[model samples]
Target: MKKLLFLVFALGSSCFLFAQDETVQALKKDAERTIQKDPNDTTSKTWKTGGFVGINAAQGSLSNWAAGGDKFSLAVNGNLSLYAFHKKNKHTWDNTLDINLGYINTTSLGSRKNDDRIDLLSKYGYAIGPKWNVGALFNFRSQLFKGYAYDDDGNRTFNSNFFSPAYVLLSPGVEWKPNNEFSAFISPATVRWTIVKNDSLAAVGAYGVDPGKHSRTEFGAFASLNYMKEINKMFSYKSRMDLYSNYLKNPKNIDVYWTNMINMKLTKFLTLTYSLDLIYDDDVKLFGENNDSPATQIKSMLGLGFLVKF
Candidate 1:
């Protein structure tokens, strides 16, 4: 009778231990599945940030070649772009800042500025529907250094300087965003300011401000369309266009600014880039071919450079 009782007690203990082990294994599997379903559990991220910086250079040297060109030419260009985006449920905010500067040296032209650009844009929106949002947009643009025009005699004439043609725009508008790559905004009411801080340029009424005045203000209606797309693993394109009409002045006359950029990746850190810009403003004047008037302006650049992204 003593042996029988001992065996029964040992068997009961073993069964209890085995049951506990099975329960623990089941719990572990359940926990892993839950983690696999939701990696962050309850927390969600709302911000995304990225940017890229690039530098491009070109150099050419001619000996006794028949083709007529400068004996030696060199150009260097640099550009930077940074952006931040936030989206959580019904609220969204986006910001971008871009800078570009370049210079070129030639036997005849010496050294001169080839490119200059500064641009910033910010927008905040609250979604009211699946595709529409109410938003406020702000934009600022200017150059970082002096720019000049060269005469036939190779004489340089000062045309612009830092803040000489700065532009500031603010608008409260409705935006339509179908996806992450396209957006359109329209505002019936907008305010724009043109600033020429340089005393000499301001005195000349540069960029449409009154002579001797530092700034000009206008109320306008504004519309902008933006698009970006990655065509493949190695190519991408971006474009934006803006239009504005001053309500207080000639509402029939419109101001336009358009920009486009295309990139082709050759390697992880090397890219070929092309950029074009078009601008038209009635208030801005340019002098060329003995004509001094407001005219459409266009610029283009192409280069291959090292690119770093973050």
Candidate 2:
């Protein structure tokens, strides 16, 4: 009878252990699912950061082709962009910095700059309504290196250098953001400054600064529209346009800057990109094939490249 009781007790203990093991396994899976559903627990993410780097290249060689072209030509370009966004409660902040620099070598022109750009934008906002906010915006733009204009004879004339024609803008504004992909900011009170740090360029009154002076200031009204969207899994686009009218000077003449970029993903690390940039500044002069006046400046680039995103 004692043996029988011992056997029964052992059987009961084994069943209890098996049941406990099953319960533990079930709980483990449930905890994992809960963690997956709420990766950050009850708190929402407050900061997001991402950027991309791209490199593009092209080359051509001709030995006996009927078409007239350089015997050998090669171009390589690189671009980098970084962005950070923060949101908590009714406060939001966004920032972006972009840099582009590239070079080209050809039989005709040897080596020259193919691209140069630097842009920075920052904005902070407090929500006044669901889709509207009171905000402050800041922008800075310059170049990384000296740029030159080359004539047909391959003679070069200095055009711009680092900080030689830098621009700064600050504004307190109302911003309307209907969605994550679009925003419009308008400000009646804005300040703009233009700086030419190069003594030679400053002496020539380049970029509207007074001759021999290194800086120019203006009070203005400003407006800007920014848009970014991924059209599909393979395509994306971004654009921004800025307009400013100087209240202290010619209020009727407005300065404009617009930029657009499009990307088509060909593979995980390959992309085709196209970019367009336009600027119109009343104080700046542009010489074109048929016009030497203050014409609208335009630039376009298209290439297939390797892209990395994070």
Question: What does candidate 2's lDDT look like per residue over 239-268, in tens digits?
Answer: 999999999888999999999989999999
Q: What TM-score, computed on C-alpha atoms, does each candidate reach?
A: 0.87, 0.87
Q: What is the C-alpha lDDT of each candidate?
A: 0.92, 0.92
Q: Look at candidate 1 and give me any clashing residue pairs.
A: none
The alpha-carbon RMSD values of the candidates against the true structure, listed in the order shown, are 4.9, 3.9
Q: Candidate 1, residues 1-310: lDDT per residue as tens digits?
A: 9999999999999999999999999999888884355655777799999988999999999989898899999999999989899999999999999899999999989999999999999999999999999989999999999999888899988889888889999999999999989999999999999999999989887888889999999999999999988899799888999999999888999999999989899999999999999999988777657536778899899999998879
Model 1, CA-based lDDT: 0.92
User: Residue 19, candidate 1: how far off, in angstroms?
Assistant: 22
Q: Give the Cα error of residue 24 in candidate 2, in Å.
A: 10
In angstroms, the error of model 2 at 18 is 11
Q: Where does model 1 exceed 4 Å of error?
A: 1-41, 289-291
